[model samples]
Target: MSQGSSPTRETSRTDNDGNDADDDNDSALGSDQYSTASITSSTYHYRQLGGRSYPNFRDVDHWEPVDEKQQESFDIRHHIYLMQNNQKLFNAPVQPRCVLDVGTGTGIWALDVADTFPWAEVIGIDLAPIQPPWVPPNCRFEVDDANMNWTFGDGRFNLVHIRDLVGSIRDDEKLYAHAFCSLEPGGWIEHTESFMIIFSDNNSIPEDCVYHDWNRLFDEAGEKTGKSFHLAERIESSMKTAGFRVLGSRKKKVPIGTWPKDPTLNEVGLWNQHRWMEGLDGYGRWLLKYVWSLSDVDIELFFTRTRKALRDKRIHAYELYTTVWAQKPGPGGQ
Candidate 1:
């Protein structure tokens, strides 16, 4: 519906990193969707590894090349419950007619949003183009680079939603700033990311526990890629700094398994547990290669043990974080 053309690929003559040209004609693909394409495109290129493809890390693309069990786990329940509760945060009369879902992996949220609002036009973008063929009348999927110029005019979107981009993006500050500029005055920008570090006043992990070891491994892996797995603390501050007027922030304790006391949470917790276990297959397959100081055997063992722990309920933990919602101050006062 935007009827915009794709950006022409620029020849940067640089390797994956910022350094100058390599022997091969390898360069990152740049987008010219927005006027300031350099910033967005450069940041996007920073994550490309010679264009080598990796399976799903956070359900940001399509279903990963994982076992059927793991893939099914991703489909059973919605991870970003905050997005489903849009009515609580977004003002409905403004009721976003144009929505952009960035890094929409299975395109579930985008599909649901389109179904909920038949009049709204929804576009879901992902790197892999893994979305299902059958979608609502108003929803469509595009295989494009969100880190490039947005392909839409400035102030184009009524609502722009991005979530779980922890493993996918390096510069959260720049990303949010761009999203802020993309919205029309008084438009809404919704972001949902996991804190990854969930806690209870009553529960504490030991320094040398397997959970601790897992944490260390993940942290090292994240640092190597410039992605932060534990970015919950920075979300609010980053949104505010990006010029979003903080509308509301609410934290939910996503349970690890069906072990939570409440029924709804218990179901979600069970799904979460399954997703974590399955993620070993989806994410761990790449970890050994990408993470520093990790051997193939090390990743293999980690995956086996992590899966076993989740299956046995040994690590029935919940991801704790607050989803922050904000608005770009609109032109007219209601």
Candidate 2:
């Protein structure tokens, strides 16, 4: 549990003669270019395209957009999660000794958890290098593709947390199975996601509104991409099939705008609106152009209408957010 005893790794570099170079002397080569540079350790090589940076993975990640807008939206969503959970990091009752954050965008949750539980060692894995270099000593971030094989040893984690990975994962069952196997006996795994489809309680949203059109486009695009936004709704059964015992689940109706009657929900709605507004262009840019095959001018006009609709309090549309947690059975299959 000491700092020195934490996860140790080494970067690999080859000399001009194609021989392995010593880790200590690798930096001594002044002018000679390394024939091969392999990262035996966790490393990130981000690719920039179309004014955005993307992760370098064998299979392209569903979420290819990355910029300041996405980061702001992520931070806003994190705050909203804290607000909904009353500032609790997670719903699991146990005080985990080790934690793994899957798809840790911005590493906000991992950093916060490290601060909350200073005794715990927190590891965050993501495709992008958006996390800051200055972080809590107990917390670390790795650029990894979660869809591939997990490198960590089995049963090494006490808690595994996933958030807002709706359109990123292609196979929920495989991811849950990995989580189930990676967790120690009695360890907990929690997945949080917001269903992308908007809803209304009292027929406040109209069929003619752009909100409906937005939902339809997203649904169609998700279907074509094989990363459905509706995948979060089916995670409970997937987790159960992966051998996790259901602990608890909760669903909250997050308003799309500041149109809620209750004061708390109104605040939540305002935050949610900010998140949507910041992400409006990024969300619609690629999907509309590539998936929906819309022209740039048309896409802009569509989002302009979408923005107006989101601000309309009369629409009264809300998104569904769900958090589900389950525990790996201990000895005797309890």
Candidate 3:
């Protein structure tokens, strides 16, 4: 285990404004780890909010939970992506000697990539330090915020991967720009995000569906917070603007339940159904509470109804996910 490894997962901070004073009083907490670059600790304290544990670092305020249950949700979501992506860790065809996994929840993808390429030095960066210490020798974890100015040095990585950062980033263009700057010229940047809206092909979901209300609230919240749940669709243009040779993008319609007849789609839908049901609380609590101004009881009741709808195989609802990858211009560029 790392020196600062605790059940609480104490980690270094990347304070943006140098103002550590906040409602959490994280500055008063002891620093257990350091960033790879110059990111002074501001409010790097792990927090318990509304009875759920959030990460130590700040990314557009405290939103996600870093508890055991939430960690399991994250890992299961990883499997869903693997099943969706045809068992490939990434589509970027690069033999990376160094790799970076941005927003690496639980570090499962980073660990798997490290195992697949033992010679690669893999680093997983997240606002939370929830990754287990027992990892491949080439793999390590860091607690850093991608929304902040990256200080990981120029031309440092061969592959920079980001996933599942829906409704979190305020300025994704800046984030993509940072990835472009950090990658070696011939390196690749691959990103995946699920659009947080549900769809039905046969109009099975009713017009007055609870999902409609939740999707509306998500839209209102995104407008209020400037973090779009539909961020994945807009990334291709941003990556193109950032000097990446944009490759063909991927779009997958992941079913929410075992509603599909196809054997593969049925298996995916089953796991995806479990994925949402298990992580319901962690998924939308902060957004609904803070942005949509919903009470805890109301949020809980809403989630209960949402889960029922998700389990209704007759609805046949599916979520859309978008993935984009591009190569930096230089020798060995794809």
Candidate 4:
């Protein structure tokens, strides 16, 4: 879930906890669940700026030129796999009357949700206003940060969805609790996030491999900022602490490159690898600013080599964590 966007523009966030090794401080939601020391401000800013080149997530002008290109390549079917699995954890109906999408980048998920349930009102919120203006009749986009004190009424939404937001939320328990507060009784909340694990098996990558180096860079940066890089192990615990009964969870191993046997999964892997390649040098573009010992060139090289190894399929490991449909008990049900 910790990834950078294109050169012209983009936005996203989610902070990790100790269940993973590296934490990118770009989480959009800051909460009282964890200490402020969980993430660094500078690192969060870098992620918001689209890694190194762009510094703002809400840059509408940056994405204005790429709408057509995005619409063409935008594949909702690929995400259906993730969404389907995530939704399975919920006991709710196929379509809820009202839905809220947090950190809705590109409005892809929000738009798809709107299209899937025409009668449902889908409200997608993001810090960057990069979402297109041409959304479905039932879908709407709002430029807002989830971490801030919200202005919504209690028990207003029937369903709330958050995905790949590890770089945007510092405190999982508090953030989910806030989401719980805004949900109507029995409303469902779903979260999908990936953990940055070492991309290796028994022998291909040595301890000094580029993937390991990349892991170290992210780890050190996260520790320095106080954001947990290991939220993978704490998802269920966090949800339970937030007063939501857990429905189910799914864990998948996402290969770094197109090495998977399944064609569709391979395509998804390729998409991820290509994204890393295009923004190769941007991964730690600002390492020098936040990290005193590391240089920008060194950081770029780490990202580049990591990208190469991914393409080479030398490493085939990353954790895909999806927990679906936790809900608050109705009155007297708790």
Candidate topping TM-score: 3
- Please count the clashing residue pairs in each candidate, in the order shown: 7, 0, 0, 35
Error of 3 at 124 (Å): 0.7
lDDT of 2 at 286: 69
Residues 169-219 of candidate 2 have per-residue lDDT tens digits of 767898888888889999989999888888998899887888888788778
Candidate 2 ranges with C-alpha deviation above 4 Å: 1-50, 332-334
Steric clash pairs (candidate 2)? none
Candidate 1 residue pairs that clash: 33-149, 33-151, 34-149, 60-105, 61-105, 186-330, 257-270
| Runs off by more than 4 Å, candidate 3 | 1-45, 58-60
Worst 10 residues of 3 by lDDT: 28-37
Worst 10 residues of 1 by lDDT: 31-40
lDDT of 1 by residue, 31-53 (tens): 22222122123223212222233
List clashing residue pairs in candidate 3. Answer: none
* Candidate 2 lDDT (Cα, 0 to 1): 0.76
Each prediction's Cα lDDT score? 0.59, 0.76, 0.78, 0.57
List candidate 4 stretches off by more than 4 Å.
1-94, 287-289, 331-334
lDDT of 4 at 90: 32
Q: In model 1, where do residues sit more than 4 Å from their true spots?
A: 1-26, 29-73, 76-94, 198-201, 204-207, 313-316, 332-334
Pitting candidate 1 against candidate 3, the one with the higher lDDT is 3
**How big is the positional error of residue 239 in model 3, measured in Å on the Cα after superposition?**
0.3
